[model samples]
Target: MTKSLVGYGPIRQTRVGVSSSRGFDSESLGYHVGQTLGYGGERVYGRLDVDYDNKGGKFDSKGNRISPDVNQTDQQDTESLSVNGSLGVELTDSQRLDLAVTYYKDEQNTDYGPDYGDGLAVLFGAKPSLKAIDGANVENEPYTEKSSVNLSYSDDDFVGSGSSLNLTGYYRDEKGRFYPSGKTAGTQASEVWQANGLTDTATLKKLASAATFVTQSEADIEVMGLRAAMQTETEVAGKKTLLSYGADFERENSEQTYYGQDLNTFLASNGLTAQTNGLTYNGGPDTTIDKWGAFVNADMDITDKWHTSAGVRYQKLKSETDTFTPIYEQLLEEYFNSPAISGISAAYGIDYQAGDVEKGSTDHDKTLFNLGTSYQITPNDQVFANFSQGFTTADIQRALRDVRAGFVVNSDNVQPITTNNYEFGWQGKHGDTAARLSGFYNESDKVVRFTDDYTVEVVDTDERIYGVEGSLSHDISDKWQVGGSVAYTRGQYDKDGDWLELDAVRLTPLKGTAFAQYQFDEGSNIRLQALAIGGDDKAFKDQQKDPDASALPVTGYMTLDVLGQVKMPVGRVDYGVYNLLNKDYLTVYHQTTYGDLNRLPASGTTYGLSYTVDY
Candidate 1:
C-alpha cells in the first residue's frame, strides 16, 4: 500500500544547519557534530538529523583501572554515529501519511573486556590483546548496529463516513554483541581453578592446555510488524463521546550465537587453533516469536468533574527456538576426522556422556486487561487510579543452556513465567508548588533474575514486590526553585513457604534526590543537586547460595554536584562538576552483582565542560 502512495524523487531542500561541540572531561577529551536538513514540496515535508560523536576513553564510571597494564584498561568506552528522519504527505484533504526512519552504530571495541580491577589486565586470561590474535578476527569483533523504517497512514474514508482509520507498518533490523568472557588458560588460570575447586597448578595447566573454554554471545534480530486502528467522534445520548479499536501483528526472529574465544597459541608458539570447532559450541539459541493482539476502548465526558476509560486486550504469542548445548561428542568426531587432537575423552578422562542430545521449544499465550479513571479536583489538580496486566517469557536461552547435560530441553523442562503488575497514584499542583505520590506492587509465578554473565536466570519461585515513591517541587520566588524525590521498595521470594528477602540485584534500595536551582536571567541558570542510597544486607550469608556469592551487603553513600548553563555571545556553554564534594564511593552494581574478587572503586570527582553553536 505504501509503495503505491509515496513516489521516489529528488527532495527539494528548504533549510539546513550544522552545530558542533567540544567537551572536556575528567579523564579524556571528546567532541561531536550534528547536522539537520529540512526538505519537501507542498505534499511532502520532512526533516533529517545526523550526528557523530567521538567520546573519550576511560569514560566509564570505574574506567580508571584498579591495577592497569600499559594499555589494557578503559573497559567502558564508546564511539558512535546516528541518523533519524520523519516525512509526511498530504494524500488528500481528508487523508494523510507519515514515515520515520532511524539508524545508529556503536563503533566500539566489542570484544575488549571490562576491567574488573583485579586480574593481570589481559584478554580472555590468555592473549595479551586482540591485536595479538590471528584467529576469529571477524568473529572476535563484537559490535552494535541497527536500522529501522516505519510508515503510518490515516484516512477519514478508510472505515466509513465520520469514521477514521489508521494503519502502521514497520520493519527493523538490529544486531548487538558483547565482549568475550572466560577463565583463560593463561596466567590467571591457576587462580580461577582454585576458586572452582582445583588445586594442583600443574594439572590445571595441563588440562587448560588441552582445550579452550570461554563464553561470548551476539544476536542478529529482525522485526516486521503491522497495526490498524479506527476511531469515530460523535455525540452519544447528548454526551460527548469517543470510541476506538485496533489490532496489531508482529513477527520477530533473532539468530543468537554463543561461542568460546579463539586462542591461537595455546598449544605452542604460534600453535594450532586450540579453540577448535569440535571443542566449541554455541551456548546461545536462535529464537522466533509471532504475536497478534486486539483491543477496544471508550471514553466520554460523562461529566466535567470526572473522566473515565476502560480497555481490554486479547493477545497470543508463540515463541519457538532452535535450542543448543555443548555437543562434546562432536569433539570425538572432529578428533578422528581432522588433524587437530580434538577428543577430550582420550587425553582428559572426563565424562562425555552428553551424546546424541536433542533441542526443544517454548510456547505461551495470555489475555490481558486494564482500567483507569481520573477526577479533577481543580483547574490544576487531578488524582488517578489504575490496574493492568502484563505477560512475558523469560530467557529461554539461558534456561536451555543450564539444563543438565543428560536431560532434554522442552517446555516441560525449561518453563517460562508470567507476571502481573498493579499501581495507583495521585498528582496535583497548587499555586507555585507541584507534587506526586505513587505505590506499586507486582508478582509472578517465576521471576527473571539477571546475572553477571549478561544473561537472565529465571528462578522457578513465587516472587512478590511492593514499593512507593513521591516527588515535590516548589518555586520559592521568581529567581529561586527547589525540588526532590524519594523512593522505598522491598521484595521477597517464596522459598519452601519460608519467604526470604530477595537478592540485592532484584531489590531496590532506599534512595532519594534533592535539588535547588537559581536563575540569573531568562537564558542562564544554575543548579545544585544531591543523592543518597541506603544499603542492603539481604543476601549476606542469608540466601541459599550464601556467605560469599552475591552475598556481600550493599553499602550506602551520598554525593553532591553542581551543574549550570550560561548563554554566551557566540553560543551556549554547559558545565558540571559531578561528585563535587568528592564523596568517594563505588557503584551499587558491583556489590550486588559480584563478590569481593571484583571489588572495584567507582569514579572519583570529575568535571565536564561543553560548548555548542547553532547555524
Candidate 2:
C-alpha cells in the first residue's frame, strides 16, 4: 500500500521533531514533540499538524526557588497540546471549497505562596500571634476548539466581458472552558484587634491553626458565526476599479459559576461553633449575545500614480442574561435564624441581605467608516495614508456575571467602545535592501478596563495613543544578512479635562530588535538576535483601594538568542539557546489573587535541540 502511494508521484509529505529543555528557573524540565503532514494533488489538498509540551518547577524574582502558595506537596507546572488541520477541494477551475479545524488545551498548577494581606501586624511594627498561611496553590485549566468551512466562486467575466466577479461564504464555531481551583489558610481576625495589647504568643499561634480555605470556579463559552462576501472589478476611465461588500452574523453564549468554603474552623474553641461550615456560592443563568454587520467599499485608480478607496459598515448587537437566586443566600438565611449562631453574629455585628436578582438585556446599533489613498514615489517605492473608525461591544461575561460583590460585579448598562485611527506609511526596496516606516494615532471613548481585583468597568474619560515603527533589512551577500526593527509609543487618558499618562501593561515606550544570519553551503545556517525593552518613566500606583499593594514600576531588560540548523544525510538537526546571559528580569506585573502587585519572573538561560526527519 505504501509503495503504491509513492508511485502516484510523491503526493504526501511528513516531518517530525522532538526536543527537551529547562524552564526559566534552570530547574524545571520541559519537553516537546511535534509532527506535520501534507498532501497535494491536481484537484484536492490537505494538511495536518500536532504539538505538545509540558514543564515543571517554579521560580521567583531574585533567582530564588519558590513553592506554590496552596500546596506543599506539589510544584508549579504547565502542560499543553495543540492540533490543527486543513482540507481543500477544487470542484472546477472557477470554484473551490475549504475546511479547517483547530484544538488547544493548557493546564497550569500555580503557586500563590502566602496570603498577601496577612502582614498588617508586621507592617505596624507589632508582633501578633497569627502565623502566615503557607503553601497556597491554584489549578487553572483552559481549553478551546474551533472549526471553519468556506466555499468560493470566481469568474473572469460576469455580466460584462470587461468585468470580473468573486464570491465567498464561510461558517465557524468556537468553544472554550475555564476552571480554577485553589486552597489557602485563613488568618485570625481577633488577634489583629486585641484590645489589651497582650502580645500573647499562645493565643496568636492557636488562632493561626484554626481555619483552612478552599475555592473553585468554572466558566464555559461558545461562539458560532457565518460570513459572506462578494467583489467585482473592471476598467473605468482606462484605470482599475473595484467594488466589494460583505456581511457577518454571530451568536455567543457564556455560563459561569463560583464557590468558596472554609473546610476547618476552630471557632468552637471560642464557644462559636455555629459557623464551622463556611460555605459560599454565586452563579446564575447563561449570557447570550447576537450580532450582525454589513459593509461595502469602493476603490479606483484616479491616475497612473495615484489611488483612493472608501468604505462604510453598519452593525447591530443584542445581549441578554438570565438571573437566579444565589445558593449562598439560602445557606446564610439558615445560619441567621439559628439560636446557636446568635452569640457569634452579635459579637461580629453581622448583618446580611440578598439583593434583587433579575434578568437583563441590552441592544445597540453602530456605524463605522474609513478612507485611504496611496501615491507612487517611484518604480519601487510608495507612500500611503488611511483613517478609520471602529467600535466594540463590552464583553458579555463582564457585563452580566455577578459571582461576588468585590470579585465579579454585574453592570448591565455598560457601553460600547469607539475609536478613530489615523495612519501613514512608506515602503521601498533598492537592490538587496528593503525598508518600511509607519506612524499611527488612535483615540477612543468608553474604554473598558479591568481592575486588579478581577472587576471590569467602563472608563468615562477618553484615551489616545500615538506610535511610530520602522524596520530595515539588508542582504550583505548570499551567505550573510542583517535586519532590525524599532517601535515607540506614547499614551494618555483624559480625566476632568486633564491628560494623564496611560499606565496599562502594554505601554512600553521604546522597544527594538536586531538580528544577523549566516548561511552555510549544505542548507545549514546560523542566526543571532538581540532584543531591548525600555523601562517606564514612572511607577503606577494602585487605585487607592488596596492598601497592601506595592507600586508597580516597569523594568527594562535585554536578551540574546542563537539558532542554527545542520543538514544530515536523512534528517536535519536544529538547536537554539534562549536568554543566553541568564538575565534575571521581570516580564510583566499582574495582580495577585489578593489584589496586590505580583511580578512575573522571566526565564533564565535555557537551550533546546531537536532532530527532524522528512519524507
Candidate 3:
C-alpha cells in the first residue's frame, strides 16, 4: 500500500480595482495498492484506491467585483474509492488475449459562498435570482456510481506474412445523483428569465420562493461499445507496406428522475393554477442515442527515403426522445405575457402538442479522410506533411433542442461540424541538441456556436485558424538540460461575417514556455519553468457600449513554477510551487452569457509534496 498527503494555498493582490486576497490551509490524503498473481501462462493484476481532498481560498467574483472578505473561504471535499482487476493469457508464442472488469463509486460534496452560483447565474442567466433567495449557506452534492467490463484479443499468424488481428469490447453503467441548494435553484430561474424575457424581476423573486426546490434528484446512464481491427504488413514495389482496417459501434441510454414536491403541488399550495397565471407543470424526459462507424487505413513506403499514409472512416448516428416534459411552455404562459412569450416561441419555433409527443428521431452520416507523407532531408533531419478531415456529431443539449424546436435553422439537418487540416513540419538533431518546427492551417465548415440567449446555432460562414509552433532543447552538460517552445496562432471568421461568441473574445495569439532542469548527483534534482500568453484585446457588447473602453485592448501575462526532488530508499519525494509570479488575467470569455470575458485572476503561489515508489 502507498499513502500521500497534499496541500495548496493562494495569495492575490489586485493592482487595478479588482478583488484579491491571501491565505493557505488546504490539503488532501490519498492511498492506493496493487498486486499481481500468476498461473501457468496466465497473469492477473488487481489494484485499489482511495482519496480525500479539501480546498479553501478567496478571490474576486464576476466582472472583477472584489469580495468583502480578504480571506473568504471556498471549500471542496471529495472521496473516491475503486477496485479493478484484469487477466492476461498467452494463447501462443505470437498471440495473446486479455480481459478486465472494474467497479467504482465516487461521492463528492462542495460548500462555498454564493460566489459559485452567483458567477454561473450572472454569466449564463441559468439560475434563480439571488436577490430573492438567501445564500448564507449553500452547498452542492453530486455523486456517481460506475461499473465497466473490458475484453481484448490479438493474433499474429495470418498466412505466414507478418500480420495481426485485434478485437476489443467495453460496457459500462453509471448512476448519478445531484442536490440543488437554494442558490442553485435560483440559477434555474435565471435560465428561464433569459429564455422567456419576462423581465419582471419581482415576480421571479416571488416564484423563486414557491418553486419546487429539489434538494436532490437521481440521473442514470448506461453505455456499451465494441471495436475490431486487422492489420497486415507486406512488400510493395520493393518497399515495406502496412494496411489496417477497423469497425466500431456504440450506444447509450439515460433517465433522470425528479424527486421532491411535484410542481403542481407546490403551485397549488402557493394559490396558483395553470389558468390563473398561465402556469404549467412538466417533468424531465428520457433520452437515448445510438452510434456506429467503420474505417480503413494504409501506410506504404515508395522508397527508402519517402513514405505515405492514407485513411478513411464512415459513421452514422441516431437520436430519439421517449417523452416530452413541457416545463418551458408551462413557465412561459404562467409568468410571461402572451406577446413576450410569443416572440420567444417564434424565435425557437416550438409547437405544443397535447398528447404524447414523439420527436422524430434524427439520423446523420459522415465520412472522413486523411493523407500524409514524410521524407528524410539529411542524416539528422526529416520533414513531413499531412492533410486530414474530421467531424463531430452534435449532442442533445440546449443547442440541439433549439435547432429541433425551430427557434433556429442550421439548414444542414444538423450535420456534423467538419474540419480540414493541413500541416508541414520538420525535426532534427545535432549531437546534444534537438529541435522541431511545424506550421498548420485548419478550415471548418458549418461552425456551431451558442447565441446570447444560450440557444445553439450553426453559422453558414466558415472559420480559419493557422499557426506555427517551434521547440528546441539542449544538454549543456551531463547534469543540466534546457528547453523552450513558442507558438503563434491566428483565428478569425470569414470576411464580412461574425460569430456571436467568437467575435467577442480573443484567443491566445502567442504563447511560449521555457524550462531548465539540473540533476545534482543521482539523489537530487531541481527544475524551473516559465510561461507567457498573449492575445489581442477583445470587444464585447457591454464594452462596446463604453466609448472609452478602447474595444477591450489585448492583454498579456506570464507565470513561473519551480520544483525539487530527493531520492530515498523506499520512494522519491517531490516538492513544487506553481504560479510563482502570480500574474492576473482572463483566459476565456463566454459571450453568449455574460457579454464579456470572465477574468481569471492570477492564482497565488501554491506548494505541494508527493512521493512515489516501484516494487
Full-model lDDT for every candidate: 0.62, 0.59, 0.55
- Top-TM-score structure, candidate number: 1
Per-residue lDDT of model 2, residues 1-615, tens digit only:
111222233333334443323444444556677777767666677677888767555443334454232211222455677777776666665555566667776666433333223423322223322222334322233344555555455554555554445555555555443332232222222333243252466754544333233344555667777776667776667767798888888888877665453322212111111121334444454778888899998899898889999999998888776664443343344343346544544565544454434666777778999999999989889999999998777665654443332222233355567899999999999999999999999999864554543445567679898999999999999999999999989876665675666653536657899999999999999999999988764426432333322325566778898999999897888889877777777654432222322233555666777777777
lDDT tens digits, residue span 494-579, model 1:
76676767766777689999999999875889999999998777656466542222335789988888899888786677777777
Task: Report the C-alpha lDDT of model 3 over 104-146, residue by residue, as the tens digit.
Answer: 7666543322332322343234542222122222222456688
Candidate 2: worst-modelled 10 consecutive residues by lDDT = 265-274
TM-score of each: 0.79, 0.77, 0.71
Tell me model 1's lDDT, rounded to 2 decimals.
Answer: 0.62
Lowest summed lDDT over 10 consecutive residues: which window, candidate 1? 13-22
Model 3: lDDT equals 0.55
Clashes of 1: 0
Error of 1 at 15 (Å): 16
- Given candidate 3, what's the lDDT at residue 84? 60
